[model samples]
Target: MNNFYKNYKGIIWLLTGILCGSVAGLALGKKIEVLKPIGDIFLNLLFTAVIPLVFFAISSAIAGLEPGKKLSRIMGVMCLVFLGTVIVAACLTMIAVWLFPVHEQLTGAILTEKVNPQPIGNQITALFTTGEFYELLSRKSMLAMIIFSVIIGFAALRSGEKGTAFTRFLHGGNEVFKQVFIIIMKLGPVGLGAYFAYQVGVFGPQLFGAYARSLGLYYATGAFYFVVIFSVYAFIAGGVKGMQKFWRNNIIPSATAVGTCSSIATIPANMDAAKKIGIPDVIANVTIPLGGTLHKDGSSISSIIKMAVVFALFGKSFNSADVVLLALAMTVLVSVVEGGIPNGGYVGELLFIAAYGFPPEALPPAMIIGTLVDPMATLLNSTGDTVAAMMIARFTEGKGWMENGEYGLESGVTE
Candidate 1:
């Protein structure tokens, strides 16, 4: 059993779990609902590491970098690529939703739940404002934590030797968190297996048939973006040959994301792909992790799709301001802390609710959207991370990176 578990791959286990869960769900129906707690435990375990993982991973990466104009340039390019693609994704989602509009009505158990509006100002303030330390632990204020980490990183960079010690401490802590995350992820197949079963039992197979049109449209759009948008990015970064190289190098990361349904889990593969595609270690190390935590084009797009489709289902139209707000929130706000898990998309769903006064009824459909779209979304997100790293390497490292010439990883080095 020890050898078996050791040899067992995570994706295989997850797929096996899904198949078993689906079978159990069909066999037992709602009778197996009692096992949901087990699935919840799995989800909770995955989320448990998220805050610390993000904080340490990003802060330490920033702190380790030598502060200078080159660092600034890379950061600028990375942010631009991440944000630009996310906005494009949101627009594409809106277009897809418009083309394949959903006309779903609230029925069955979905009609029973309603979401009340919360105080939006305080929640919004929590995003950019810093105060109590306790706020760092609150998942709702993840942006605040990210901002705080950035400050710490810069401060440490300026602190000289003292900062080095602190940064090292953070790096050590990050390793610890990574190990914990791996341990928790090992249980994912079992946990998510039960989750799949519960979802299938609760929703039934007809759920897919019911939402087929909208779901089909969402997937087709995903394919379009992956093939077209990524190709454009690759061409711009490394030209035609570069685009071919990127797709050829990216298969592992893409497969890992689709299988695990988590961009975070694809970090190792992303870094390797980046290396194969000639991105420097400095850029890959910093951007890949940071991208995993922040650059969420995939999730942003899915959120837009959900908002547009759900509104259309209820026979409503979003005004111009609402559209602007949706685009900004999904592109800028939710991207910062979008996790790489099954329900990670829920974070954006809340943003939709808060931003647009979407009712709780929005959640049921939103969840269905997540189930259908998350795998492709993760693939997009992970692939985008690699593309950003490549672009940044090209822009910051210039000829060496673009020409696929050999370059040593030197800190604060300039030609």
Candidate 2:
């Protein structure tokens, strides 16, 4: 029990906080409103470290890439994996919407027109541009950041000795941000407790019922998607034995993410597991951290699924163009920016719904519903990260210092 607690202290504390907050909110009655400010402070602290962390981690990972064919292949495979997951997520979302439609009357109070719509052309322009203009448009700016980072990384790789200084600089920055993240996370229990209490106080326990319904749908769809998609990928990558071996080693991290519902917090364990599975340290370090920032398949899936359900509930069917655009936009957003920010899935879902001129009344329930699915999303996403690391290791096996099975191959694949 001591060892277990030592390993899962964060998750245990988070759960304890939530449980206490829920009870307090129920008992405190009107006083529950006081928790809101405290919760906001916690959120702010968590978010404060995100942008710097993302920029530094991504830059370092890209900079570490070898300049030649190996880098190109890794990038290509990463892109393909990201794109494929996005499509699967979008499709699963559409299916969820069709299966369990949200009733319009239930969300009538949430409908409003508070947000001003941005021009599509402007959004597209911001997506491709650089500098202050891009920063101002946070949602679309990720594409620009990704492009810029790639170019800089490639340049760094080509510079040889000159790049060493820059690489060390970025690596130092990453370590600093990670330390800051740890400091913030230490206060997680307090912050999460306050936030959880405030939510219950504001919305009441009745809201949890709605949250549960949407959550059930999200999980059902997600499970189906995982079984069909990841299973196939695992089989192709390593066969039945490989798939089994991978899951056996990774189950702890996956379960930890699900229980904690925070991918960033699960990084330590995930990194450890990746190493145990025979993935090269450099690849594991680069990919897992980058994946936490960039890969958000589960969040994307839930957001789009919730959006479709909300749209169907309001009797507003999206046209083919809107569907195509939404899918494309979601794919890019999920791939580049979604997981990098705190409460990112919630913010992105609301923004996407508002962008399409959907009714505002749907936002609150959608947000609540989304949280219930967060754990599942986190689990799937963490799994995706580990899977990508394994795949990269497989692809780059022969070229690197660590040959096949030398580092403790779990998949029974002989060198």
Candidate 3:
């Protein structure tokens, strides 16, 4: 039995769960109904893991990055790379949304009786206030926790011997949690299968019908982004040879991202790919970690897709101002603060819900789409990080970056 489990891949199990769960739900959900609790158990486990998983992972990644003088320069280049990708991703999403339009049909969509839209001022105020120390304990306040962790990470670096010990402790904690995450993921088949079964039972065949085309477009655009967009960036950074090296080395990282669906979780794989593609540890360690947190073309692209679909469902038409606002939100706000935890879609979904004053009911469909496409989105995001690392290395460290040849440091990279 153990050997059988060992030989089977996790993705296969997850797919099996989806297939079996959907079948069971359609066939036996009303009769049994008891299976709902089983699915809930898995979801609760996932939620339980989110906070500590995010806190330790982000801080540890930050602590493990190169210290002092090199930090700012690396972070700056990475942010630029992340922002550039996000803009391009946002543009692509807008184009896809325009090309494949969703009709105004909310049948079988998750609905709420009434939604009291919060004022923009109130929402902004609440975001910061809700992230206070006490409020940070709440699941909704992950943004605050992220900010706190980054501060603690930088402080750990400056604290001398004690700081080094603290960083090491966080890194150790991160490793332990990764194992825990794996263990939880092992149950994904049972959990996801049950969950999908319940969804199928409740919504029936219409569940797939509602979001199919929108999801199809999103996925098609994502494939194009990976092949065409990434290749273009690679060429700019390292030319033909560099592009070839990037594609060759990217296989593992991209595959891992699809399986894990978490950029933070994919860090180790991304770093490995970076090394294989000849990016130095100095560049990889800093840029990759920062990218896991900040550079999310995948999430940004998904945000636009979600918003477009949700808006269509709500029967809201986009004007020039609405389009501008969406571009700003997707390219900047949502892209930067997207959480690295699995099922972290709600953070961005909340932003989508509040920013456009969409009825809170619209959130479910948006989050549903985000959840469905998470693996593909994460693949693009994580893959882009490694590619960006290589690009930055070549541009900043010169064509000999692969050879570890020293290039001129920017003003703050050295003492």
Candidate 4:
């Protein structure tokens, strides 16, 4: 009982605040506008801190990789498992939207400025690299920021001995910014509570109607993916016995995913679960940490729903081949390199807007979708990491990886 409260402290408060704010909105209606300023203050803080947090978090993880430390066959197969799972997730979402359309024309779509989109070639180039270093500092150029961070990481890695001090600097900045984010998120219950209240008051019942439809769609899809698709993955990874071990040990990580809503937060539990499941220590170490940032089935699923909502509001046909393909590509891009912090999907949401040339107005409402879907998304995202490690173990370590009470034997140490 004490452990449950300790583990779920963040979500319990946040959910309580959200429920209270919803009741206030239902009671007070548009008068909730008075609370908008409270929400905005927290939002401004989050936006300001996110850029540096992303920069250091991404750069430091890559920079500190010490080349051949664990970068072996596990690394190779790990990338494949991540990509395969995200593709499945993306495809699954596309199918869900087709079967159960969440489309509704948002009245605010008319308020958008005329979008004079740049050429595809220019947009693609700008998607990855900012012409000026200063441009990467803003949230709008998130992909560009990520690319810049990656280059910085590789550059630091190539510098070998001389880069040791620089790597330390990145690591220090990463820890500092993580702590900063923790402090900011401590305000999430109040901020998001007010934000939800304002949204329900202004948007009226559409917050429950259109937005709820979107939420329902994502929840249904996520539940299906979690139960059915993940079971398939577990079966594939180790057959019946392997699947049993996974189900047995996955509780702590799954609970952490819902409670904390952060894949990075769930890593220790995930790694411990992997240890208990008898995954090779080498594979667990490489795959679980790598998956925290790189593998996100939930985001891949949610990204599609987000794009679908944006398109529906704008009266665009999401069934188009090219648009669907672009969404799939973006989600794939999003899933592989997503930041694992709470609300980190904000970066990927921006990418969706820019990639499809959606109006800036699309972001706020879509962010609501991200927030609503976060717990379940984090469930799939974090738990999927542990499942992915098992799959990687299957491929790299071969069949007997789970043979002869192997999973019960504790960590199978393999350098």
For residues 1-415, write the lDDT of model 3, one tens digit per residue: 5643543355456667777877887787565357768777866675566567767877887777665455565666776777777888888877777776655334554433444546657655654446347766654555556667788777886776778878899999877876776788778778767766776776576666667877888889999999999999888878898899899988888877766656887899998888788887777877898788778888877888787777665555543564556455545766765554434455566655644555434544665577678778888888899889877886667777766623234334634
Q: lDDT winner between 1 and 3, please give it.
A: 3
User: How well does candidate 1 match the true structure in TM-score terms?
Assistant: 0.66
- Higher-scoring candidate on lDDT, 3 or 4: 4
What lDDT does candidate 3 reach at residue 383? 88
- lDDT measured at residue 330 in model 3 versus the true structure, 0 to 100: 43
Sort every candidate by lDDT, greatest first: 4, 3, 1, 2
How does candidate 4 fare on TM-score? 0.82
Best by lDDT: 4
RMSD of candidates 1 onward, in order: 6.1, 6.8, 5.4, 4.0
lDDT of 4 by residue, 1-415 (tens): 7766786676677777777778888889989989988888877787678778878878887887755455556777888899999999999999999998876535533223444556667767877778788888876677788778888988998998899899999999988987898898788788878877876776665556777788899999999999899889999989988789999998899988887767898999999998888887767777898788888999999999998887776667788766777788889877765564445687677667866766555665676678778889989999999889889878876777765223432433333
Clashes of each: 1, 3, 0, 0
How does each model score on TM-score?
0.66, 0.65, 0.70, 0.82
Candidate 1 structure quality by residue, lDDT tens digits, 1-415: 5633443355456667767887998899998798778887866665456678667866776788765545565677788878888888887777776666554422322323343434657546755665899878655555677788788878878898967789899888767876776777677667767876776687677544445666777788889988998898888778887898899998899888876667778999998898788887778877999899788877777777677656654445643564556456655666664553223465555545544545434444565566556678888888889987877777777655755434534655432
Better of 2 and 3 by lDDT: 3
Off by over 4 Å in 2: 3-7, 69-78, 102-113, 127-147, 231-328, 331-415
